[model samples]
Target: MKNVFTTLLLFSCLISAPSITAADERVKIIPDVVYGHKFGMALTFDVFQPEKPNGAGVLFMVSGGWYSRWTDPQNMLSWFKPLLDEGFTVFCVRHGSSPKFKIPEVVEDVRRSVRFIRLHAKDYGVDPSRLGVWGGSAGGHLSLVLGTTSDKGKPEAKDKVLQESDRVAAVAAYYPPTDLREFVDEKSPYYQRFPALQFDKELADDFSPLLQVTPDDPPTLLIHGDQDKLVPISHSENIMQQFKEKKVPVELLVIENAAHGFRGDDQTRASQAVVKWFQKHLAKQAD
Candidate 1:
C-alpha cells in the first residue's frame, strides 16, 4: 500500500527501503549532534551517503515550520531513502521550528548546517564545493537563503566549516513560501496551507527568501501546483521574475489543478524534473 501526504511537496521514499538492501552499504545515518548549542539551542541533522559514490554532491533537506529536534522514530524520517538510490549524499536537518526561535535564528541554523557539511565533506566522502539543497515550505525558504546568501558568511573562521561559504550548487524547492509578508497578508488560492501559526508581521519581510536572492545565487528549481492554496503559485511566479532579473538560472514548474502535494498527476513528473535538474548541475560540478 502506498500512502501520500497532501502537503505542497511530496517525496515517495520507503522507511524499509534501505534496511534490506546491500546497495545502501556506503550510506550512513548520523543520529544527533549539536551545531549551534550555545546561543540558538542545539540544532541537529541526519546525513545519508551513497554506496560506491559516482559523484561528490550533497542534497540537503531542511524541515518545514522551523522545529527543534526530529523526534518520533518511525515518523522521524519515514519516506526519504530514495536519494541513496540516486547516488547523491542526502542530509535532513533539524533547526528551531518557530515562536521558540524567530525566522532569523532558524535561517542561521540552516547556514550553520551547510558550513558543517562542507567543513567535513572529505570525512563524509564528498567534495565541499559540490553541494545542493532541496526543501518544502519553510525549508524551501531556507534552501534559497543558504544557497543565495552563502557569500555573506565569513570565509576565515578557525572552524573550517564556518570558513566555508554556505552555498549550494543547486536547489529544488516545492511549494515554498518565498515571501512571508505576502503569505500572511493574503490567503493562498488553495484552502489547505502550512504556515507556522506564530508568524511575526514585523520581521516577515526580512526573512523572505525571494527578497534575498542575488545575481550570483545558485541555479534553482521552483516547483509548485497551480491550485496550491497554502503557497500560491504567485510566489513561484514572483520568484521566476526575480530570477530572470538577476540572470540566475531557474526552472519553475506549475502543475495544473495541483494543490500543495501535486499528487494526482503532478508528483511523478515533478519528481523526475528534480532528478534531471540535479543531474545537470550537482552531478556535473567541478571537482
Candidate 2:
C-alpha cells in the first residue's frame, strides 16, 4: 500500500507540473560566456538581459560562504527578476571556488571578470561607466572590494581587456564580511574556520574592504541583519562608517530580528532595496 501511494503521488506531480514554453519566459539569457581565462580554466558568466534594457548592467557576484559555485540563470530567474523587470542587464559572475584557489586569487579572478565586462560593454548593450555590482556574504566582500579597490587599467598590458577599468558605479551587498582579521583572533571561533585566510595584518588588510574605502568608491548600499552571527553586524557597521568618513555615498539597512540571511518579508524588503539602489546609482544620467 505504501509503494502504491508513493507511485500515485509521483504520477500526480508529473501530470500537475506546469508546462513552460519559451514565450512564457520573460528574460532572454546568454549562458556560459567565457569572460576570462585563468588557472587553465575558462572563467565564465551567464548574462540575463531584459526584453528592454535600461542601458545599465549589474555584475551579480555568484558566491556564498567564501565558496564559489555557478547557479543556472533559470534557477535564479525569480531572485533576479526585480532587476530584469527594472530593465537592467544582469551578469551572474562566477569565480574560482575556494579551497582550490585561495581568497586572494579568487579576488583577482573577480577583478579580471569586471575588466572583461567593461571591455565588452558595447556588445552587451550596457554603458561601461554605469555598471554596478551586487552580492552577499563572501560575494559581498568581493563586491565591496570592487567598489573600493578599483584602479585605472595598466595601459601597457598586452591584453586589451586588462587595460579597461574594473571600477563600478554602484554596489549593493548583504551581510558581507568587510574585515577579515578582525573576525579571527586567538579568542575567536572563526579563527579555526578560515584557515586559508592566514590571520596576518598585511593579508587581512589586502582582503578587507574596510581598509580600502576611498572617496572615489562607488555609491554603496549594505543590508545586514542585526542578529547575524556568522558575520557580525559590526562588519557592515564599520564599513558604512568608513564610507561616511570618506564622504562616499553609502547607506545601511539593518533588518531587526533577522539572522545571517534574511527570511520572509525581510528578504523581500532586502531585494527591493537592492533594486532601488541600483536604479539611483546606475542610472544612465549618473554616468
Top-TM-score candidate index: 2
Residue 157's lDDT in candidate 1: 69
Q: Candidate 1 regions off by >4 Å?
A: 1-26, 38-41, 68-78, 155-160, 183-202, 285-287
Q: All candidates' lDDT scores? A: 0.66, 0.81
Evaluated against the true structure, the overall lDDT of model 1 is: 0.66
lDDT of 2 by residue, 1-287 (tens): 34422321221122123444453297889999998887788999999889899999999887754566665557766677789889999998988876577678888888988999999899999999889999887778889999999988999999998898889999999888898876546555554454445445457787899999988899999999898767789999999999999999999999999877665698789989999999998887832
lDDT accuracy of residue 88 in candidate 1 = 71
lDDT per residue for candidate 1 within 45-101, as digits (tens), equals: 766666655455655554544434454323333244455567776676777765466
Candidate 1: C-alpha RMSD to true structure equals 4.7
Q: Each candidate's root-mean-square deviation in Å?
A: 4.7, 7.5
The number of residue pairs in model 2 that clash at the backbone is 0
